[model samples]
Target: MLKNDQKVFVLLENNNPQVESLSKQLEIPLITQKQIDSHRDGFFLAWRDNKLALFDIKSPKKGMSVEFDARSMEQPSWPAPKTGTLAQAIGKKTKTVVDATAGWGQDSFHVFRMGYQIVSIERSKIMAALLGDGFERLGNQSWIQQLNLKSPKLIVGNAIEILQNLEYIPDCIYLDPMFPAKRKKSALAKKPLVVLKGIVGEDEDKKDLFACALQVAGKRVVVKSPNYAEPLGGKPDLSFAGKLVRYDVYFKT
Candidate 1:
């Protein structure tokens, strides 16, 4: 069994005084580690916040793998269409998407499965490492070989810079950033997410992300928000409903 004592130095978001103050005021833990390495292959960073147990690898870009349950990769089955997913929203108008905040690549995978080509970006090296590993595993899956599932093309670096330089503008740019959890009582209980949150920190630059997404998207930008949080970048011209939240859409001219 892999020991839990593994530790690596990662820049803590709370290392900044202002960040630390906010973490204390908001009561959010900061991120601080990179995880498991393989001698033959590259290392992976664990997304502690994700319940899905996703791990992205450290190197080898493009056709990156995403590992969900080991069982799911080996077995051929489509992930249930998350009915109210952002994929469904943008899929209606665009055949391609850029997940500007790819994170653990959950939403990016969903977008790809919905038949849209995806360009995903992540800034955190640890998160990118985890994502890279996950994509490598995803690429090697027997089912993926048999069925030819669409795999994400991941780029490690700031989306704000990468998106601006992309040759083609995608139909949609999706953002599912880290927002303050709804309630403090509800926060402490999300164990899987807590770990990830500790490592990635909150999406401190969500505002810039939204602006950049708006500029780069061909048709529109969809921002996923908790039901209780205010719409990002003000009210959306249109919105699609989900049980617990809404997809706020900002159409581009």
Candidate 2:
């Protein structure tokens, strides 16, 4: 559910019934293409090639929509999961994980694909809606059906509050709190990252989030941060490195 002040609405090319149905499901206004032209300012959820997506009309170019794809599952061979990346970070020891900051859910998706019972939490209503759509798309894939894969349960709220009230603790708590951009030229140009930054803003309470995650996790809390940002909750018990990101693992004493 979105805040009353949220300007998001459903953009339709015509009086399409599917769009109307989806609008009701999303609980937003249904507007025509002409309405979109007039209100080309805020964000809107629309159908692009029969797939639901969230797009910002403020972007520089057109046809820019934020949708999710499990790249690791789709193309397993090339750019495969690295040795010390997400898979290995929560591999043998971590049975269940709670991803506290599930942005686009790509990391959460890959973590789930690696066979961890995972749950995700996102505070932004817009991001949560997009993530819901993404998970739905992933569940509908033929391979997912053959393998009988289900989407990770999503909890839409401030994770700092939700993590504190969990019924049962998980083996690991994963945090990928958003920080100000520090990447190179190419990484900054990526669509989802660019769009997410524009929409979600920075995680001001990330340290508190790490502290709360530390309280409920059974085994450890894994904080994903750029190598330069320092550890989220001071020094980590162990650390694993990726191309640009690193997982700072804090084991429960």
Candidate 3:
């Protein structure tokens, strides 16, 4: 049975003593939920430890709906230009783009709106579920009803494991991995942070992810990084500047 208490607890598995200890240290209650038995065919309903949503165990590549209300509750100021933006750094000729680290599908959705076929890849199972739910709602919007635009494709798995196996080679590849903040004071409040923190922990293997992305993009790769962060691949051949962010562009030449 689900915990009825309003105060959230840190849910854990019986085998994870370290996690349980961490939960206790944080002053959060630790609750354990029963994992449903899988059928002979290897299918079982996916569920969250404390969350109410009935999350199906499916990769984001399969598709899902995101709540419009939740997306509306938070906003991130996207960089746009008077003429062209960082998105166009790969050039207007490019069509298909893959977001290698599609944490919450924000960047992927923006690229989809820009008349490109986007393949969004999110690695974490929980993040993928949230993204899947969001995409489901996004696909059925009234505006989508009038425009008849197809939804962006979603792929859930370690990007390093999936990118090289893709059947299609995208014209542009995009990456925006989580980076350590320069100072705790500069951190911005993002709605996805709480859930993502629980699922992703920390990104310790970004170097491997970058190598995989470099192997997959056909024409170019674009990486979004903070102004103070180092370039993704040494110095990019070209770069676009924003107020607090930068887009590093590497060409296939």
Candidate 4:
């Protein structure tokens, strides 16, 4: 269930069967573009340029989608070189990864493009639905089809429980749980993150989630956190730093 005070609806602007099906699948109300005025205070899921996008009521014209191509400007190649701080934290030998907190799935997709087999878990049904739609689009891409590559498997559930029950333990368990903003108001935060925070709230049980990851991961547990926040599990055995974020790694002995 979504947090109280957060209202979401599916906007069906046309008679597209797929969009209608998505509305039914999400169990959210299907509203037409004309009906936007009536639901002026709610967020909406709508198809834009054939891609499913999430739109805030305040800025209905501007929406965000789970985009794979957007990163191409910065990383012009497919399966981008595994040479960043993130890759360092994940380790060169890690082959399989479980993204235990796949909110918008950006990190999960990045790891997938880096050539690691990945399984993504998200507890929020709405986010999971968006992820499913994105992965479906990714599968239909020309390169993906040519290479027979599949998008990361998405599991809709609580990671704390799901990690314990995975059929095979992954080499690494990745955590990027949400933390409260440093300021009293989050108006300065990115629009997508602000909307996500409004919908899913914060990851209040990150400590417990971290403990579960440590127990389930075969090689190590890597946690991504804002630089200002304390390590989730006391101290990490190793830490890798990015511009504004940090990856804390706990190796399994």
The candidate, 2 or 3, that scores higher on TM-score is 2
lDDT of 4 by residue, 116-210 (tens): 99999999888888888888988777677666788889999899999999999899999998888989785657777888887788878899999
State residue 226's C-alpha deviation in candidate 1, in Å.
1.0
| Candidate order by decreasing lDDT | 4, 2, 1, 3
Lowest lDDT sum, 10 consecutive residues, model 3, at: 36-45
User: If scored against the real structure, what TM-score would every candidate get?
Assistant: 0.69, 0.83, 0.68, 0.91
Per residue, candidate 1 scores C-alpha lDDT tens digits across 167-231 of: 99788888888788878757443443544565566877889989988988889999987888899
- Quote the RMSD, in angstroms, for model 4: 2.3
> Whole-model lDDT for model 2 versus the true structure?
0.75
- Model 3 misplacement above 4 A: 1-84, 185-191
Error of 2 at 16 (Å): 3.0
In order, the Cα lDDT scores of the candidates are 0.65, 0.75, 0.63, 0.85
Candidate 4 residue pairs in backbone clash: none
**What C-alpha RMSD separates each model from the true structure?**
11.4, 3.7, 11.2, 2.3
lDDT of 4 at 148: 71
lDDT for model 3, on a 0 to 1 scale?
0.63
User: Candidates ranked by TM-score, best first?
Assistant: 4, 2, 1, 3
Let me know the TM-score candidate 3 reaches against the reference structure: 0.68
